[model samples]
Target: METKQTDIKLKTPIRCIVKLGGAAITCKNEFEKINEANLITVSSQLREAMMFGSSSGSVLEMDWSKRPGMAESLVKVDDYKEQLVLDFSSFVVIHGAGSFGHFQASTSGVHRGGLNQPLVKAGFVATRISVTSLNLEIVRALAREGIPSVAMSPFSCGWSTRERNIASADVSAVVEALDSGFVPVLHGDAVLDEALGCTILSGDVIISHLAAHLKPQFVVFLTDVFGVYDRPPAEPNAVLLREIAVREDGSWSVVNPTLEDSDKQVEISVASHDTTGGMVTKISEAAMIAKHGIDVYIVKAATEHSLTALSGKLRDKIPDDWLGTVIRHVS
Candidate 1:
């Protein structure tokens, strides 16, 4: 039965929503060191993926600082904004504050409790400034790539929500951008009051929300690790599940639990301490979205062919046995 289910296929080529994890974008060993080489590889693949779509990009990033590095970079470039708009010709982008506001706000404990605290006002201001700076860098990078990207904040788009509202808005923004012939980019950032309160929003959650809204046929989650492991790779006998089904009911049961329960059962783990949410959170989020009929692939950002594999065109380039965890929709 599991084999039959895994073998099922979709009748059409659905749109895609790719979520690039911060861990994938930034290095886990060193947060400050941007993985330029890895990013270039991912960007190259993303460019390839864009060819398949009418328009592709990201949601605007929230402002993190009163003065942002990206903003400054943009200012350094003559007609940076106009040049960017002319590059891709049409694209939408969303960015998260990354360390800009999160590091400071989290440390200050301003919005420590949630979005409703009076202290949140300070946190909000700090995050806005930080996000602004982050956006400037992103805009500059995209310009260099000739990707033609734009940055927008949740505050400006009226996407403020208690918790997941920002994510919903991000998805809406992506759809709008695509409709308008632009790609949308989005990132994890701080949101005002909600259950999680002052905690950082997970990029995985952002991607999941987008999948739910756009029903992108394929969802790719790029992280630092190679892929979902049955056990931490450091442990003996740890194996990769390769593929799993996410039942519409939101369950991640294995096909043959007893076959490798001791070595092949997928375990939830965190890639780093800075990551507020870990593997479990990502899996749960992706599983929920899969229930809505989207297929998700979680792969390591460092893998040279990661994006290509997700695009269904890198099979020949990768080892014949190479495979990543596949989360499917099982009703």
Candidate 2:
């Protein structure tokens, strides 16, 4: 018997996982209302990218449950998905629950609250309903854009934990979609489980999972700030880490250290307990994926040139300290 090699050619057009941070879609400042103008601007850029075929697919991950009148937001996402499909004819999308599940999980102190809480049943119900509503908005949005987009829930897709398992399923779906020439839109949502009960999946986790499985040329994490700042941006001389090297200990080291005596080392930290993953989780996850030889870019979504930067078309146009971090394998 002859042994045959499995020749699975990587899909074309460059498969990428574009993470739209919740903070980018929500309030930049406490006093400011939702940034509708910025939202529209970003959406237009995405539309243009799809129109010209710069991006193979896109995913919008936000926490809609926390927002007021979430039903309305869902409508917006659906409308956008629809428009994109009609206009561009190809593209994948994913969104997160803005605030729907965040509040409940936070208050209950149950990282996976909805599964077994009878007292907080009302909250759980509301969260699920709100997520569904938000999904509708994404669908409608794709319709309006003439792009065919689909909404997926954790429960529906068999996501029950915050570990690599969730990432596995998500990546499987994305790969399936790409192989069949369909765009898969995923979002952060509450998933029901009999084993761990119920848990809220974070968008960052989803992105990390995709990168690990797909091993794309690069992964792009878009946020409100220009990129990761050297200081907190409030202080003077706050610089950005242009490139990060993954260490054997699974930590990221910047070229420049913040203090003279201190090592130029930093670990991505989780944002909150309610959220499944955070910056730290993302960095760690990206580092793991990089070990297999992948590059990750953390950039500011607010920058109009973000898409161009990721596409490697405007390399000379971006500044040195653009407010983001790049993680790559040293070896």
Model 2 weakest lDDT span, ten residues long: 1-10
Q: Please, what is the TM-score per model?
A: 0.71, 0.71
Please report the candidate that would top TM-score against the real structure: 2
Flag regions of model 1 displaced more than 4 Å.
Answer: 1-14, 29-31, 52-102, 110-120, 163-172, 194-199, 256-259, 262-266, 271-275, 314-320
Instruction: Report the Cα RMSD per candidate.
Output: 8.2, 7.4
* Cα-based lDDT for every prediction: 0.55, 0.55
Q: Give the TM-score of candidate 1.
A: 0.71
Candidate 2 regions off by >4 Å? 1-14, 28-34, 51-96, 110-114, 162-172, 193-195, 235-237, 256-274, 314-323
How many clashing residue pairs are found in candidate 2?
Answer: 62
